[model samples]
Target: MGSVFCEGLTHAAMYARFRPQVPASLVNYILSFLQEKCKGPMNNAIDVGCGSGQSTRVLSSHFKNVVGFDISEAQVAEANKLEKLANVSYKVNRAEKLPCETQSVQLVNAGQACHWFDLSKFFIEADRVLVPGGVIALYGYQFPMPIWENKTEKLTKLFTDLYLDSLHGYIKKESLDVYYSNYRNLRFRIPFEDYVQIRNETLYAEHQATVADFVGYISSWSSFQNFQTQHGQEAAYDILNTFETKFMNELGVNTSSADTELTLRTNYFLQLGRKPTTTTKRGNSPVEKQTNLTH
Candidate 1:
């Protein structure tokens, strides 16, 4: 149930500090679909693999009670430490075995962390906990593209090379394979109704951060952490230092400070499915609604 990537306290803290929060538009997109088949008011929503409660906290605004689950104790502890709404709580638990009662949860969501789960077991658990018409939303963002005033294209290429080329060897292929395929490689079975696939390749979860902050975000990547573990801090930091220097140079910021501010444009994808209602027929074929929404 545990992921090797997110283990220690330092990593968990860094994850909480740097990972982007779930965008409100994406949340609304999920909820809109959930509300369509939902019987009554939105009640319980669970955020599985909820690292540091960033995604979990957002659900508090819509649900009566929102619970976040993660396999890492350090992550749950860091989530608990954060100031969240009274209705939101974090627990150390695995995705395959949810703690909720049968037919109780309205929505079961997994953010960037879904790729690490045993999807077959987790789907069964999601089916067990969700109400007949409840929704299961699996969503994640791709590597962030750096956006400056006018040099957006060149900066994006630089960022892409940093992620896909420089850190390629460090990436855990098994989990990232699912992620890199945008979860399309995952096979779904019966009892789940229609499948809604949304790929917003340009939908930006706009985040304002300094060059140091961006480096912090990059360092939070599991691949980067792996690199740090194997190569040691000095060697690993050399990569970030090079990135910082190049990024600052592109922006013409000669202050030699890592505090140069920039915007991060992250693309998102969502795979949504619904549990069959009482009158709905259980079928092997899933109806798919695919959309490429640009924002």
Candidate 2:
């Protein structure tokens, strides 16, 4: 947890290419909640741990300005390389200390990246930067389940087994734990009000895949880098290939036919909190003394 495993340029690029774009439906859902609590203009937003700006760019249409922040310079660089939007930018920064001025942001969000943060510090920073009654959203997806025409149940089990059994050890314990829990285990310590948690096992991000696309997506995993570092690329990909073979076989498709089509369906979860409109405290709020450390 001391450093981001996916900070390498190669991994960052792969991530930018393969990671699911934050769905518009999900973004609207978060914004809907924000609108109810904060009646002010949607001036600015911060996308925390925004790898390659997937979540950041999605917020551009919702806010006047949006910035994505990540600890990895490679990630920020990759994000910046994408088709630029005038109101969207990427910065290399930590989640615990956002760069915006206090009370200047209307929404703070992290998609599939909040588990890496020290939530306590992040919450305080989020609270500090958000306007009163602003919203904070943390959302992510579970490992994708393959739906092969009508064999969804079986294919899903196979992919789930591969993830939970073969790749689990390589993944960080905290990350895996949160994923299995659908992020229900995370604590929101910002003293937020009107908290809402959404768990939709039916939600899915559809992707058309080739063998290479499937392999590349798996390779983009942060845990895969750890596995590759320990076992070497050949040894690591061997496992992926073996699973790919099984998956392709399950669909009655030849492994040689790399373009065999199947849809990947993934579940989504969302956690939201709104800062209190009124705090009676005079000075030195809990958010102001986060860790007694500088970002």
Shift in Å, residue 130, candidate 2: 0.3
Highest-scoring model, lDDT = 1
Model 2: residues with Cα > 4 Å off, grouped in runs: 1-9, 186-190, 193-203, 254-257, 279-295
lDDT of 2 by residue, 172-223 (tens): 9767866667677735333454444444444456776654566667778877
Candidate-wise lDDT, in order: 0.76, 0.76
| TM-score of each predicted structure versus truth | 0.86, 0.87
For candidate 1, the lDDT comes to 0.76
After superposition, the stretches of candidate 1 with alpha carbons farther than 4 Å from their true spots are 1-9, 188-202, 279-295
Clashing pairs in 1: none
Worst 10 residues of 1 by lDDT: 286-295
In the order shown, the candidates' Cα RMSDs to the true structure are 6.4, 4.9
Q: Residues 1-295, candidate 1, lDDT per residue (tens digit)?
A: 0122223538888898778878898898889988887959898999999999888998888999999999999999999999547999989999988988988999999988777886666876787788888888888887776788889998777766887889888889755675468666635222254444544443458888766767777789888889989998767778887876787778887654444778887778777787777533222222211111110
